[model samples]
Target: MSQTTQPLHFARQPHPSPVAPEQRAELLRNPGFGRVFTDHMATIRYTEGKGWHDAKIEPRGPIPMDPAAAVLHYAQEIFEGLKAYRTADGGATLFRPEENARRFQKSAERLAMPILPEALFLEALDQVVSIDRDWIPEGDGSLYLRPFMFANEAFLGVRPSSEYLFIVIASSVGAYFKTQADAVSVWVSENYTRAAPGGTGAAKCGGNYAASLVAQAEASRNGCDQVVFLDAVERRWIEELGGMNVFFLFEDGSMTTPPLGGTILPGITRASVLALAKDKGITVREEPYSLDQWRADAASGRLREAFACGTAAVLTPIGTVKGRDGEFTIGNGRSGARTEELRNTLVDIQRGRAADPHSWVHKVF
Candidate 1:
């Protein structure tokens, strides 16, 4: 991530018609994930010659875009998802937002877009969260933050756009899954793959997700909560689930997930879980695990439990797995003991309920 010579100053533009306290309270009471947004959003612009400028914390609304914008045709967009949690003292905190900024830089580099300085990216988040602190829900809730950038240059050429827009918007969310269940079922996608070798799978870009929608829909049709994608080449190695990383626990007290060579995303939550597991004296491996191996191990009682981890679904136990051939259950089809232990440890640190030795939490308000 690049460093700006001078700190970018954000100009505040209060909403002309802000939501009343009563209405906002009502919305916050039942915000539902990604349904209700905060009153304001943060924005910054970039041009070829001039660097990132026009920083502002303005009212949440639409952006007037040109029909001929490059993003419209070429789909040059990247985004990051993090959350702001309300602490016990009514203060708000962010969980390793700088890491998100650094990942955003890597995503930009992959998409051939200019990198916004990490400081600037963070300032935008702070601005949005600080100004809309009221939207942060209490008790196991958070304000979900979406930071995204898109090529905005009104040119139809095949080259990368010369201009871009970076914006951060917040939503008061309760939980990602409506059921808020401990365990979820997954469908092994036989027909669809998320990304190919040397593709944008590692980047947090819209194109990667757009490509996964069909596979996700297939999972839903198969009566599962999410889709588990296999390697694009062999179509047998377990790569990842739709939007989250998967992990396996063995009876020998070892944990394994797919190695992030190139195809799978390097998830922040996945990394944190690995570190936490190691601290608890559990062995963690990033070795390749095939679908055949997974099924065999789960059946032979070698593999105890498996779970998916991400920002949205912090850690959900994988109770059952279904595919074209058959379905299998993992460890009594319930949340496993080790899975719950690690999730509680991670969430405690994230929510400021426990001591953070890694200093991952960043208090924004």
Candidate 2:
């Protein structure tokens, strides 16, 4: 696939009936995740031979689709999530949006979907954010951006679609957890598995999330906040949480997370945490840790902390682990010092409070 070097110019189609400032302020006061959306959305269409075209920022509304659309039958879809933060200088910026664009391309290729050019992806994000800058909430709140692509072709016969639609939308969101110190409990899903050796585990697609819904429900029923899945084959080695990646902090000032082979989603937040930890002279390992070892370490005071990482749930402490084998607490069932430090460091860099040494934050305004 050939990549476009030049930036794609997006057409502007302002929304006629946008939310009033008063109403928008009211909604932004407590904008939960994925609940309230901005007035407009950015879109681009792609044909097999024509490449990507008809790029515009239009109003937010329901999309017309055929009953037998390719996405309905085969589910050829991919999406990426990131946030636009309100900086201290009274401006808006995005955290590692290019990384999301690259991941979106990898997901598209895995699903046999046309890779939306990286330049177009970034342009779409900037266009949406620039128009909906007011939707970005103040303080700890942010504007979450969701970029997605799906097969829109009407006819489908168990093959890839010839046409696709790429769209970007913005939403005002609060923190995933109510407070930074509120740790969550996890339930091990022995009956369900998230991904296999040659599956779409690594792809940020809707199907992967759809498959984990049942396990998540099980976790809720078990009185836990999230569900953890182990390897599909042995069911002993820990893979990841329902949607987030897991990390373990040892008592010896070291950390370990399951290596990314083909069954784990390479998260941007996870990578940032690993890099930050390494920069602080903390020993980080990407080796597989089994559930048995996790339990034993927790019981023997070998494991100091455990947490989950993702775009939505930035860095949440895992206080308890429950399964049919029994339940156990990790490090006195509280957020550890290292976990809090890493989370604060990352959040500071994101909100423009700390120096961006790696140039991860992209200023849009």
Candidate 3:
């Protein structure tokens, strides 16, 4: 799909009842994931014939939806997640926002939704970040941005909706995990699989996540922090966690992660970690890793470290893997040296403490 010819011009409609500085400060002190929201939100409407229009920054509140909305019935929706970081110089920036935009476009295509122009996507990010700059917390915290689109047309038909709503909202969030040193344990879900061939596995859609909730609940019930899914067909190859991609670090300074063969979400953080590893002269491979092989390697001391990567968790070390077969500890059940090194490197680049050779940091101030 191609971009619309008309340029987007966002109209400003400030929130009348913004939070006071002291109250906002209290919320920012411990924003905790998606618990806290900013004062305003960015929105744009799209019609089949009129294209995207009526771009505006408005107050954060409930969206009016018809009881028979298309999204409510058919689930034509997609979203993107990225964060705005607080720089060392008292400024703010985004980490590879264009990448998120491109992924959003891909997701829209897979779900038969309207393709939002990349320029407009970036502009939406800028508009929200600029308006809620103070919502960005200091130190280890940042403003988490969630841009999503859904079918708003009130219809009962099983086709693409004629009307859609695209919105960008911001939340001040602290680290996902309480401590970086504490590695998370994962449970292997033998009864469920995440995606299959020709499925919406690679797309950042809501349905994919909604379907994984049961398995995630299973993980929590099993005394685990996360769930790891295997391939659908053979049910042997390791796919990924519920929302994050998996990685295996070998003792020989080599890294391997499941290949993206239409069965895995191409995470921006995953790509960044691969690039960072290669830059450090570490060998990185994208290939299928079997669950049996993972167990054997960890047992035999071949696998040195394992971690999951995503926007929210960043890079989290997978210290232990528990399954129906058995349980095994990886690298003393703690975060390894390479995992710590790579995590620090990425955080440094995001926070402007190190040189950005790839120009991934977009300054918003």
Candidate 4:
């Protein structure tokens, strides 16, 4: 594990009503995604003076909170998503989780909340996965871990909460897409913006995602799988999708993605993809890519491929990019060779089938 040693103190709680084996088996047969959870969760409390305390692993249930909780009103919350893979040795491992921890702290800082120390973050993750190791599904399935923090203070005034709570929960996830081969279609959202200059676009906060729902709905109506958002200022430069980062492949054997100008989430998968591209001796650029550039390239066959990356989907090939003026199709409405190669390289390292020269994978046990 590429993590600093941290002592995890756990208070175990027996689930009063854990799912029966038959029920769990039924769900496991087709676990869809993020619908069902394990028997327990990990939690830790924080206050202004005491800092983080009462760290414990508790039953999977609700946390009693005042109606006026800070998170409910002011929406001061942050979260991280990563997976624990079931290795061929029957052991479990987490993929580059320390990166997620660092991003969590950055998100908290953006929300004006106390940073959950790296030690605490890793400990909570270890505790939950350790106690619920059986929940780590086999085959291509995984135990999706969600670590989140929110202000629990009940006061109506919202400067920054003095009280906060951090929790880690695990769920059995089958696949982000039913079939990995299906090329995803995207709708270009011209009006709705995911983030603005000096806004919380970079932060993995609820508000940023909430604002993109309308655009996502439009995509669904247009028979598209996802929505592509633009920068709030120019509205010409491509930003990202509703829940994933975007990337474009050029004919010169180079790739480009929108730079993280404090207006985009620096995805762990995005960083990992760039590293893998460099390993393959491919040129990668993190620059401002616009819709016009993509359109022109597609028309001239210079843009060979496009894809989206995130912890959930890993890598999603973009089949079509549709907007008001018109729509441009890429690679015959199917996954391109370059897109498949990139996806395979990532999955190989993640599943331990290939050597992780970058040392991105971390063993959980």
Q: Give each model's whole-structure lDDT.
A: 0.92, 0.92, 0.93, 0.87
Residue 254 miss distance in model 3 (angstroms): 0.3
Kindly report which residue stretches of model 2 are placed more than 4 angstroms away from their true locations once superposed: 1-6, 178-181
- Over 282-358, each residue of candidate 2 has an lDDT whose tens digit, in order, gives 99999989999999999999999999998889999999999998999999899899999999999999999999999
What C-alpha lDDT does candidate 2 achieve relative to the native structure?
0.92
What would the per-residue lDDT of candidate 4 be over residues 128-246, giving only the tens digit for each residue?
Answer: 88878878777888889999989999899959999998999999998786545578889999979999989998899988888999999998898788999988998999999999999
Across 1-365, the per-residue lDDT of candidate 3 in tens digits comes to 34567888889899998999999999988889999999889999999888898999999999999999999999999999999998877789999999999999999999999999998999999999999999999989999999999999998999999899999999999978654557999999999999999999999999999989999999889878899999999999999999999999998999999999888999999999999999999999999999989999999999999999999999999998998887999989999999999999999999999999999999988
lDDT of 4 at 81: 96
Where does model 4 exceed 4 Å of error?
1-8, 178-181
Clashing residue pairs in candidate 2 (N, C-alpha, C atoms within 3 angstroms)? none
The collision pairs in model 4 are none
The count of backbone overlaps in candidate 4 is 0
C-alpha positional error of residue 57 in candidate 3 after TM-score superposition, expressed in Å: 0.5
